[model samples]
Target: MTDEVSISRRRLLATSGSVLAAGAFGGCLGGAPSEGGRSGLPSKVEVTMTSRPTPKFEPRLTHVAVGGTVVWTLESGDHDSTAYHPDTYGPNRIPPDAEPWASETMSAVGETFEWTFDTPGVYDYVDTQAVCTAHEQIGNVGRIVVGNPELDPDAQPALRPPQSELPRIARTRLEELNEQTHSLLSDEATTSTEEP
Candidate 1:
């Protein structure tokens, strides 16, 4: 026999090249196989706010860890996300009743909101609809420093109003210094009523 039929075709091509190298090493270490083949718990962070170039509110600095859970997805226009506790959210700092841990109003486009901090602190938010007219009084604002690695030395530092109530820009030398302090208080009350 031809040396036992060339050693049985070299043992059937080395057992079909070791079964095609173990099916390419198990498909490069087992990938593409989820549903029921089970293996999915990875996205511990994802913050999106789409609508290309015009409608804002993307990432805007979002990070999670302590208890972790922030799933805000409003991929287009129309938005809302109140959460103002850092002293009434903003401008003139509105802390009278301060109630608003979650208030996803007007969430039209795609609409999705999910929050879960599990106590750490500092979670100011905004965007209560009028998306642009003053856009939450300019800057739109957002901050959620849960599990505090920093901000929260007794919090209250997000919108520290008191710079003469911040929101200015109407000057002609501040309107001629308020008309020379109203013409020196009407010439000091007409020279103090001719001195008594």
Candidate 2:
């Protein structure tokens, strides 16, 4: 019994320590998730949950190197970090062998969830809370593109699920979200060129 208790305590401490380290390092790095030392990892990137002018992720689309991580920080509204998988209803966008992850739908500001991309693939995720009529199924979705240095981000970002297969609201929202991403990318390209 004592040994079991000690093991549990040790696990808890280790988990807690990592969480704290992630929080501190992520905060310092402007909200990106912290990763254990690894090669080929592009620095972590962040997707923020915003409630002010709109309830949505700050960067709905993210691109990272194959071994990178994406951090989702909940600022408001009930939300969770959920990967697209058969369990979540699909047209799955993740790699066939990628493990799915989800966070409990909670509204606590500063709550964060992180996932590391090991395989080069497109990963679509969503906030799994039913705050809106189609909250978890629609506008709450985001995309992560884990690209190989040798190739583009792969089929991840473009592997959107069949819109016609979803409920009307979800389909409409998804289309709108895609358009927003398109516009955002276009804007970013223009901005980048202007920078020089």
Each candidate: what lDDT?
Answer: 0.46, 0.62
Global Cα RMSD, each model: 28.7, 15.8
Residues forming the 10-long window of minimal summed lDDT in candidate 1 = 34-43
lDDT per residue (tens digit) for residues 94-168 in model 2: 766677777777688888888878786656676667666446544667766565322222444334543465556
Q: Number of clashing pairs, model 2? A: 1
Against the hidden reference, what TM-scores do the models get?
0.24, 0.60
- Model 1, runs deviating above 4 Å: 1-67, 73-77, 80-108, 113-121, 128-132, 138-145, 148-156, 159-196
Number of the predicted model whose lDDT against the real structure is largest: 2
lDDT of 2: 0.62
lDDT of 1 by residue, 1-196 (tens): 6999999999999889966774453233221122111112111344555546644455444434455566667777666666644433434222233334555554576677876665544444656567455444544445543332332223333323223433342122223323432343344356456555
